[model samples]
Target: MSFTQQLHQAAQNIWQKSLVHPFITELQSGQLPLTKFRFYLLQDRYYLVEFSKFHHLLAEQAGNPQIKKFLLQSEADLRACEWSVRSDFFTGLKITPMEIRQTAVAPTAYNYVNHMYLTLERDGFAPAIAAIVPCYWLYQEIGQKLAKVGSPVALYQTWIDTYDSDWYEVNVTHILQLINILASQATATDRQMMQTAFIRSSYYELQFWQMAYAKERW
Candidate 1:
């Protein structure tokens, strides 16, 4: 199979077999409670700034022009999300920026993302792309599912809005296309290495979410 097909298949497997489906089911069932949801939003609000910085660095180092452009675009999207969350905090929740900053972050979860960025910077763009694939793929999948269900939940809207934002979608598509192009130019060893990195990154992505959910619950 082509690299795109392989990556898509891997993502499909993750969606079906992993915690993502269960988490979405929980959201659909309204089991997370408003308090937990609010906490999650606040936590993510702070993290987006760091995440955006990481992506900005990655985009600068990306070998493919298209991928670099997409990364730059994603930085903008992350910033917008950060702004939205901050606005909601002050106006909607009456929370202060200091409170948001002082909120306890899940170290393991944040570290994993940081590690991915470091890996990308150290290992090379192909592996970095591989490492980050799960986030993009998972977001795309979740967005599509939520959009299909047409749910009215605020959390659903949040997820869909953030993941399905034009910038996110464009980056996802660009990354997939770049992977295909790179795959064609790669040797068998390179392909295997990239695939291995991609799969490991996906697992880390799963862990990141699981850790975030667990930390917020605490």
Candidate 2:
């Protein structure tokens, strides 16, 4: 199987959980509490800060110019979104910049982002990229699924559209290509390690929704 296919097969159960997860179902149906979504947004901002950092480091360490270029662009996209959280996005919701700044990372958020950092620090760029791919790929898949039913609520529909856009699918393809390229040269052991990283991160992605559902803190 292609490396991307192998990784997908390995994480099939996790993807199924993510697809049918109550938190996501509720969000799509406009049944999710705003407070829960607000909590998710808050933690997600913190998560993106770390994601941006991951790409910055990847850009620096990558030998291939294409990889470096992709990472740089990825970081820029994340930072642009981060910039919007305070003003364009959440301003009307009373979620001030200070409130976002003051919100502590929940345990799930901390573990997920920290795991990304740790993967890069411990295993170098390729595995780290593998580890983080599910966030984009799974979300892209979920977004497309969501687009079919399409939320009735304006705000929730906006979220769905954001993920369903062409840009995100491009990113999914780009990242998968990068991973496949890296996997091509990897030793059997290294490829297996990469698969492990992908599986573990996929698990964390599942937990994140549950965390939001429970409105976890501390």
Best-fitting candidate, scored by TM-score: 2
Candidate 1's clash total is 0
Candidate models: Cα lDDT each: 0.66, 0.86
- TM-scores of the models, in the given order? 0.79, 0.95
lDDT of the structure predicted as candidate 1: 0.66
Best by lDDT: 2
Encode model 2's per-residue lDDT on 1-218: one tens digit a residue: 89999999999999999999988999899998888888888888788778888888889999999889999998887566434533445765678878877888899999999888888888877889998899889988898999999987777787787779877778788999999999998999889889999999999999999999899976
lDDT of 1 at 218: 37
Backbone clashes, each candidate: 0, 0
